[model samples]
Target: MAEGQEKPKRLYQVWKGSNRFFCRGRLIFGPDVSSLITTIILIGGPAVSFCIKVNHTINVNKKDGKDSNYWYIVLFVAALLTCLDILFLLMTASRDPGIIPRNTKPPESEEGFDMNTPSMEWINDRTPHLRLPKTKEVIVNGHPVNVKYCDTCMLYRPPRASHCSICNNCVQKFDHHCPWVGQCIGLRNYRFFYMFISTSTILCLYVFGFSWVHIAQNKEGILKAMRKDILSDVLIVYCFITVWFVGGLTIFHFYLICTNQTTYENFRYRYDKKENPYHKGIGRNLVEVFLSKIPPSMNNFRAVVCEDDMVAEAPSADHVRTSKEKIDIEMGDKFSESNGISLPEILQNLHYDDLEGNSKDKERSVDFDIHPSPFVFELGKRDELVIAHETENIHQV
Candidate 1:
């Protein structure tokens, strides 16, 4: 690929090894099950347990011996049902539904050359369902080609997506790959990912509250319950440990969500020099994260979520503009208060005597978006000269 030209998408053969025998996506099952297990404990387990207690109480009040036993059966059945539901979801989430035709419409482009031929296919053929990595081979085209690879898709990965080794699979839309999820939390599963997090939090809260009730109720009967040492009572102890674990994590994640930061970012960007674009403080973060306030006026989602194939494609003027504008906005602002905002924290932590690099420009815009950045932070005060330097770096790069 030439400078400023799109890289052609390459094709690759799908790994034909017995997918079921070894590891296709089946290998990921461990992590998948881990996520589901957490979700089940955090989501359905408490809900069912609560229902069981209610039903058990009502049956006893009605003086119906058969009905009371029926409630116990109900508890067993509900537990079984929840387990089955999780199994079903796992199976479905694991399958590779063959590739659907790409309906990718290019953003309004000023550059010429219509590559949007309906017949062209950029994904894997064999495992249309699986993402196969592609490789390159030179071939002559009748006409001079602007790029061997499709501009929309980056380097030619075959059925597999060109996952940022960091994110792993070339997840669909590939929203910043999360290592914890153990899969690409992309467009296809974005809803599930969010649902998983949201539901997990709620389940934790419910389990935490519900466990307290059982702790109180069972405390009087703890020795009596231990007398039998039945598996059902064992589950209760497991539930108690689970309650504390999930409760702490869920509350921490809630704080992160309200601030529009992922757990990944919480540690990942702690020492970074640039500011996070998504952050808007606790109140604004909560509003946007929970309420889905996708700032109509500030639609910057595209910067991070274009197709995996499209990353490193020549960034459009609009993207450049968005990036430039964001940098300008950052540079224009003053890092005033001493709150927990990441940029300010980074700035505040720096000491003039401890710094060595150029510290002349303190008014430059600070952007945390660029990778392999050259524009240095104000180790002392490079901020002034940094924004324009960033704007230039972005446009030229």
Candidate 2:
């Protein structure tokens, strides 16, 4: 018998040795050490609390000659809620959060723009005036929206998407990163996340009420009985206090759903002069966020309202080509896709001053009789040196 027990104990130790478990090429258990500890606490804490409460109820019922029917019903309800809480928690923790797919192709209009062609009526009022040179700009819902290219994801971030520094992925309709849950609250898993917190709040409330009643009914007063049944009463009090925070979160999420806003959007644009562009009516917002079965990012609609004044004025062709050549010289032939710098990183550092400087200098240099065309200057290993240009932007030197 001792040998049989030892064999099983050795097997258990072997199983527990690894931090990961796989089933059919899927990770069924284990993420990281912190998550593992969190999972154990979430699943184990409730289970142990339930067991202690059940044991205490059984003992006290026998002493009083009372049936355990009420206690059994309360336990049954609590257990059911626990199962649901675990189910939603796991679903939220494991599921994908609608990461935007990386853009694979270069952005160019399939057909060249025809100014003569009739514009789409549905285009945003701000669309007609928005112009970004050497970059694709699209008109959506009357607004001219810049199609921002992402360097890390190596794709264009569609509107309403932002890069999560923690996850290192662009999540569409990103809500927020929840450390407590050890995951991002985003498009795909948001429903499950909401359900988990809501259910957990209910479970906590139910357990607290039942445990309080059980302790109160004892011959001793609530405080003395609580001291006597320390584990069960302590769990009840802990859950009772915790329920407020969880319940508040549930209520807050419900408000966000109603407003058709994510936690990210709420924080980012909370005090912005404009209302949330995504805000449909309250009825539609709730349906869209919570009740609607449609996938959140399926439509991929970007709700940007661009201002007309922000558009850049087109520069002369000679200046544009000359500046382009100057930039190419400065960047050199080595700045290819495989180069050290990423496009997104370059763009992030790009300022309106950089673009304006080249154009302004070209015009200024011509006026001062410095050169007919802008001198292509390179900041070499030592310092700035001017490189002569032939045939202007006609060909690279």
Candidate 3:
């Protein structure tokens, strides 16, 4: 590309192992492959141990002239649990983690409004000071919660949405990134992820118990057992330790589901005194989080506001007639006192720029919009402004 020419936008690539690739962002696979291989090994090791123990138990029972029906039952239960574990694992690993789409049509209600269409709604008295972590702190339902904004997606994020650095997209109801599953625990796959952990923990305990029983039935106890045929005994010890980790995760997620809190919120808002807004009653929370039916076309909804809409009402003039025309609209006291209107807490700290960059010879005109929240200002020579998307971490100044 020539120095002055714009670079072609890179096409977003989906993760190779994903079942569907509807989200537009870079998919990272470096850590995923290893995590997947580890999960397979963990699942396979127990089954192999069960098979070896069953064979050894059958042989001992035959020599001692005892019924081997108990061993068969144990084998059946272990196999069944293993299958369930695999099923949920696949569901979690491949399912879309609820990617929030970007670059669609502007919302219906905001359609007729241009950049200069001023509304008293932005300066209303009912706004709250509550800030969501990574979003435009728009007052919704009387509270100033953060509306979603992803710099990577170059779009607004919806409520209960967050960006996964690993997946490189904003996910709805984001729980946490799970290395074990090689995926994000999000709205679409969170229930299945929980089930997988719960079943895996149960399977470990069940197989451990049966393996111990088979080992105890041998002529020599675990201590005196031969070094060669102690595979069942070894597997029991492994499960005994591994179960604690998996069981702890299951219990933690169970508590999260019951409280209608995500793993992200649990860590981020640990000390906040206010109750979680998403929480309902315990039963309702469980039902909604686990059993709610998701529509296939949920990803189709998008947030699209064109650059043209931003500059439609911008002034054509290059230079203001006087320095007095350059106004600072963000200071709530000055703006409110001058205009005799109370500004909302969100719009109280607004600032305006007449020029795009530090060049004295060139002039610019600007207009601001709060929905997408990027204040577009025309720069000298260029017909468009190319301000980078602001990240949530930048405090509203």
Candidate 4:
């Protein structure tokens, strides 16, 4: 749009990750056999409802063959899922998802130094952006606005803020983008998202567990469910077989979350072709991610790391580090305690990064930089934009 200015290369990501789902990039929480997840949800939602209608309940009076056959179908699906979970675990231990590590180029401490090898720390080890200029705050819509323009998403952002491409807004408490639920988890919808996952896991386990009862109630039906369709009908046999695929994904994700690891970190446990300077970004970054600390960004990437973790075993997952143990964090002088939620004070409670925000932390951090080009959330807008264009077209036509 300007002289001598070339258009930026198109960056595409349908999900939370930076890479396309089908690329050699690894799958973190999805189905073991790849895009099997979409099918599982599609089928599970309907199949479960159908089974409930016919059987009257998940725990039906199954002294009869039909009841038992239904149970076997459940078990058949569950067992298959167990195997997928095993595969997911193995993949986590041996695969690479290509995580973008924190930047060590500026070293937070040294601005002008050019070094070949950046420091080896995790993404959770650095502040996301340079501190805003020390000045009085301006209140916007009754709330104080802290940061200037975000170079990453290319807009002025507020504290406790982030840009969600799926929603195409700077959401507070930015969580991962989810495709199945058709929403980005932000501060407002995060509770529902967590509830959805927690409940969904229970549903999977519930269905999988009942399969055992089905096998016990009717031995013949159980065998039939397990039997590979010798009829050579791929469609019919797959009904039960796909159970293994979906079940595995659900269980695998359960363990990973309980132990406090993202699909990204789980894969990072294996090999990464890119240099992971910020190897321990998880150590305590969840608080920041969940709490939503927006800054004047450069790229869409945020470089900040949290002081401590919220989960019980948070230290192991969020605090996990590869090398370089020493860390100093800085806190800014101005911090808001709206509704008694004080970030600067809370950040002070952590062991990593100094509590003095401003020019202080910028002097010490080694591995982290905010990435530019936040998500291009253009969903739901198509209808609105289309309507406006159509109005103009009608007038012209």
lDDT of 4 at 267: 49
Q: Any runs in candidate 3 off by more than 4 Å, and if so which?
A: 1-31, 104-134, 138-144, 226-229, 297-397
Q: Model 1: residues >4 Å from true position, as ranges?
A: 1-54, 64-182, 186-195, 204-221, 226-232, 270-272, 293-397
Order by TM-score, highest first: 3, 2, 1, 4
Q: Write the per-residue lDDT of candidate 1 for residues 1-397, one digit (tens) a residue.
A: 5799654432111211111212422332213334645555554655565566646555664784434564455455545545554554454344321111111222122211223232122232211231211112211111110111222222222111223333222222233443345344432343345545444444444444444444444545766644543433544565567656545665766766565554444654521664444456788656544454221111111122223433222324432223322221111122222222222122223222212233434454222221111111222232221221111111110
Tell how far residue 93 is off in model 4, in angstroms. Answer: 32
Instruction: Return whichever of 2 and 3 wins on lDDT.
Output: 3
Q: Write the residue-wise lDDT of candidate 3 on 1-397 in tens digits.
A: 6899754432233121232233443222323646866896798777777876787777878998999898777778777888889888877776667755433222122111122212211111111221111223443222334443333343445445676757655576778888888888787788899899999899889888876676566566666653545677677788999899999999999988888778887776631665454566799888786776653313322223333322112112342223322221111123323544443332333343333334322232222221122322222312222222332112221
The whole-model lDDT of each prediction reads: 0.34, 0.50, 0.54, 0.33
Q: Sorted on lDDT, highest at the top, how do the candidates line up?
A: 3, 2, 1, 4
* For every candidate, C-alpha RMSD to the true structure in Å: 18.4, 20.2, 14.4, 18.1
Residue-wise C-alpha lDDT for candidate 2, range 10-44, written one tens digit per residue: 21122211113233223322233257357547655
**What TM-score do all the candidates reach, one by one?**
0.39, 0.58, 0.62, 0.31
| Candidate that beats the other on TM-score, 2 or 4, i.e. the better one | 2
Prediction 1 global C-alpha lDDT: 0.34
lDDT (Cα, tens digit) per residue for candidate 4, span 1-397: 8999754331222223322233322322322333335534554553444345335434464643334565456545644543453333333222221121111121132111122222212223233332222111322222333333222222223232344443333443243455654344333444334434444454444544444443444446656744632221222344355446555655665554344344433443521332222222543344433444433212222222222211111112454433332211111224333333222221122122222223334333321122112112122222110110100101000
Please report how far candidate 1 places residue 336 from its true position, in Å.
31
Q: Which predicted model would earn the best TM-score? A: 3
List the candidate 2 regions with Cα displacement exceeding 4 Å: 1-33, 36-40, 104-147, 294-397
